[model samples]
Target chain A: MLKKRIIPCLDIKDNRTVKGINFENIVDAGDPIELAQRYVLEGADELVFLDITATQEKRKTLTELVRKIAAEINIPFTVGGGINSLEDAKAIIESGADKISVNSAAILNPELITEISKQYGNQCVVVAIDTKFVNGEWMVFRSGGKISTGLKAVDWAKKAADLGAGEILLTSMNNDGTRAGFACEITKQISEAVSIPVIASGGAGTREHFAEVFQETNATGALAASVFHFGQIPIPELKNYLKTQNIPIRI
Target chain B: MIAILKYNAGNVTSVENAVQNLGYSTIVTDDVKALRSADKVIFPGVGEASSAMKYLKEKGLDQVIRALTQPVLGICLGMQLMCDSSEEGETEGLGIFDAKVLKFPATALVPQMGWNNFTSLKGKLFDGINLENDCYFVHSYYAEICPDTVAVTDYILPFSAALQKNNFYATQFHPEKSAKIGLQILNNFLKL
Candidate 1:
């Protein structure tokens, strides 16, 4: 049986792991390698690194950081943000990320998803959609939620799946940064709409929230940043809680 | 020397990284001679079947791969291509395993992607690894359970998670990306 994945998302700024992390065991919180090693120790199924410094100049730095992380971590990791082209995805893959997550670029050019997956495999391409319930319907968001694509969130997920995207990383902008719970309604809708795996990202406050996403919907994975970075919910314990709930989570 | 066959598929970089972590030097190449002469060959992939098979046939490396007698390990798509045929694109495989690959039914998620455990482990490839330990898997297609199957993993249906026949070994899962237990499986293969 394929266990529901537990993923930890991190932010990288100028080649440093930063954002809401406060751990004394970390030699340098800015160091993604150190933090990645710790996540491995915590029994995380996978890791997501969103490069905050995704500028063209620092794109090289992100690749280098990926190489560093891949060296120390054996588990699958994804590198996202600023992935604007096939070449960009290639560089990151060459740097050793198991997969590449595309957001704004994928929205701007829906064909980009097919092209990247064509060049690389669909397994290498993860289309991340930031959706928010806007104007009575869940709409796709871009530019860090400032712009809306006016497309229904579930419809967009279906489109991405048709475009040969192996997986969908659906992030609810409204639920994001809130410790309430996942946007299960939209997640369940999208999961049913597509045959591909849907990874629910955003608003994972408690271990139950993770369980809720997996139970309420067909979400194959759940991701959170603050909850993990702050050590509010240790991954090992979270997996334990989900396991006891009869959720087949990776232990 | 360890050689990881590189072609149209992805995941070679990750495979190389894992091999190096195992303390063995490796080369990611499609070169004919290097592949033939390597002490051990790791055939790893992540791509469409027909296109990948086309790339292999075009490079003329397919024949070289077919001829290698050393212990050759195939990972994921690499394992799929080693079968007799695959339903994906109706592609014909290398026939090493005398098995055919089939897509998981849409009733369940197409790609049963995540950590799934193994049981009924056999062969040196899985030696010393707990049969209950979960390993990472990401694939829409699965190889059928055959006589060569050394391990079993049940998703919507039970299938060959790991297969071995003579010198050729393959896994439906990505052992390289499967964490510590995954590394142990790779180590077992290296020793074999």
Candidate 2:
């Protein structure tokens, strides 16, 4: 059976790992490479580094960091944020990152997803959707979750899958940093609708929350930032708990 | 020297880094002479089969790979292309392995994109790895169980996790990205 994955997301800003609350109020956690090595030692299934750096020369710094982390860490990792073109994707992937994720860029130019997928295989293209509930409906947000694209969450996910995205990284902005739980309803909606794998992100507070998202939704992976970075939940202990709960997890 | 074949694919860099991390020097190249003369060859790839096959044919790596007497291992798309055929893009493979690749059924997830364990392990690749050990996988098409199958992993159904015949070995999983167990497998291959 395919085991559910517990992924720790590290938001990167200028080559350092940081965690944000509700997409704001960022704080330094530690060195990106050191944190990556620790996560691998702690048995993180996979790692995701979102380059939250805002600068004209962001690409050089992110790629350098990616190269360093890739040289040290053995597990697969995805690099995202500010990757607006095929060239950007190539730089990170050539730097040794296994996959390149696109969120707001995909919405701005949907063809970017297909282009990257065509050049590299679809397996290396991850479409991350940051969605917030608006007017009683989940609307897609771009520009770091500050702007709304007015696209339905499920519809955009399906479109992304059609556009050659191998997996969907669905993050609920409304539930982000809340530490309540995952957006099970929308996650179920999107994961069920698409044939591709869905990684549920945002609102992961307790071990039960991870269980709830997996048990209630078809999400195969759950991602959180602060909990794992702050030592609120150790990955090995959490996997053991999920095993006790009858969820298929890799220990 | 270990040579990682470079031909219209991804993960060549990752594979090189993994081999180098294990204290083995590696060269990522498409030159026929370099690949053939290397002590071991790693055919690591991630792309469409038809396009990959086309590139291999254009560069004449198809014949070079088939004639090499040295140890050769393929990963993911590299493994699929080693088989007789693939349903992806209706592409014909290199006909090295006796198996055929097919997409997963609609009843299951298209791509098994996480860690999963394997059973019925065999061959030098499993020298230290156990059934309880899981490997990272990210693919939709899988090679059917055949005479060359050395290990099997169940996802949508039982399929080839690793295959071996003579000097040619292949894996459906990404050992470069599978962590310690993966490194163990790579070291096993290197020692062989």
Candidate 3:
């Protein structure tokens, strides 16, 4: 059986682990390498590093960080943010990251998804969609959920899959940092709408929130930042909880 | 030397790093001479089958790989290319394994991403690894079960999770990305 994945997302700013709530109020978490190794030790299924670095000059630093992490960490990890071109994707990939995720770049140029997918197989390309519930609908947001793209979340996910995205990282801005729960309604819609795997992100408070996302939607992965970083919900404990709930999980 | 065959495919860097972490020297190369002379050859790849095959043929790696006598381990797309054919692009494979690769039906997700366990394990490659231990897998097409199948995994359906025949060993899963269990599998291969 394919087990549901518990992903710990590390928002990297200036090469340090940070947590952004509702796409604002960034706070220091810990060292990425130490946190990554700890997650692997705790049996995290995978990891996601979103480089929130603002400058183009410091983009090279992420590649170095990716290299150090890839050299030390054993599990699969995806690196996103500040990747605007195929060359940028290539740098991260060559640095040894398993996958390179694209968000705003893909929305700005939907062809960027295809380009990365072509250069490095779709299996290595993750399309991250930041979405927010607006006017009774889930709309796509870009630039770290700071701007709306005006595209429907479900529609964008389907389009991304068709564009050759191997996976969809669906993060809900409304639920983000709230620790309320995942956006199961929109998650179900997007997961069902795409053929590729969907990783639900944002608003993961307790172990039950992870269970709810897995059970209520077809999401294969549930990603959280502060919950895992602050030790609010430990991964092993969460996996045990899921297993008891009859959800297939890797322990 | 453990030579990781590189023919414009992706993931060679990760594989190289994994092998080095296991205390084995590795070289990422397309050099026919280097691959043939290496103690073991690790053919790691992540890309479309047809395009990959085209690149291999262009680089003359197709023929060199077929003639290699050393233990050659293939991972993911590399495993698919070791088979007879793939439905991915109606691509012809290296014919090392008498099996065909086909895409998972829409009954489940197209790409079976995440960790999945293996069953009916056989051969030295799985020596230390526990039976049915989960390993990372991320692929849409799978090699159909055949005589070469040493291990099987059930996703949308039962398929070859790992295959072995003579000196050619292949895994549909990404051992390098599968955490400790994956590292054990790689170590097993290196020792073999």
lDDT of 2 by residue, A1-251 (tens): 78999999999987888988889999998888888999999889989999887455878888888899889998999989989999999998989888999998899999999999988888889999999988899999998899989899999999999999989999999899999999999999999999988999999999999999999999999999999999999998999999999999988
Poorest 10 consecutive residues by lDDT, candidate 3 chain A = A53-62
Which stretches of model 3 miss by more than 4 angstroms?
none
Error of 2 at A99 (Å): 1.3
Full candidate order by DockQ, most accurate first: 3, 2, 1
- Cα lDDT tens digits, model 3, A48-145, are 99998745798778878998999998899999988999999998998988899999999999999999888888888999999999999999989877
Q: Count the clashes in each prediction.
A: 1, 0, 0
Best by DockQ: 3
* Steric clash count of candidate 2: 0
Q: Candidates' DockQ values?
A: 0.76, 0.82, 0.84
Residue range B1-192, candidate 3, lDDT tens digits = 999987877767778888999999988888888988999999988888998999999888899999999999999999999999999889999999999999999898878888999767989999987766999998889999999999999998999999999999999999999999999999999998
Q: For model 1, what is the alpha-carbon lDDT of residue A120?
A: 77
Candidate 2 backbone collisions, by pair:
none
Candidate 3 interface RMS: 1.0
Instruction: Give each model a TM-score.
Output: 0.94, 0.97, 0.97
Tens-place lDDT digits, model 1, residues A1-251: 67889999888877777653121122224577887899988999999998855989998778888988988898998899899999999899888887899988988898989988888778778999989887789999887667878888888899889998989999888888778899999999999889888999888889889988999998988999878877899999999999999998777
**lDDT for each of the candidates?**
0.87, 0.91, 0.91
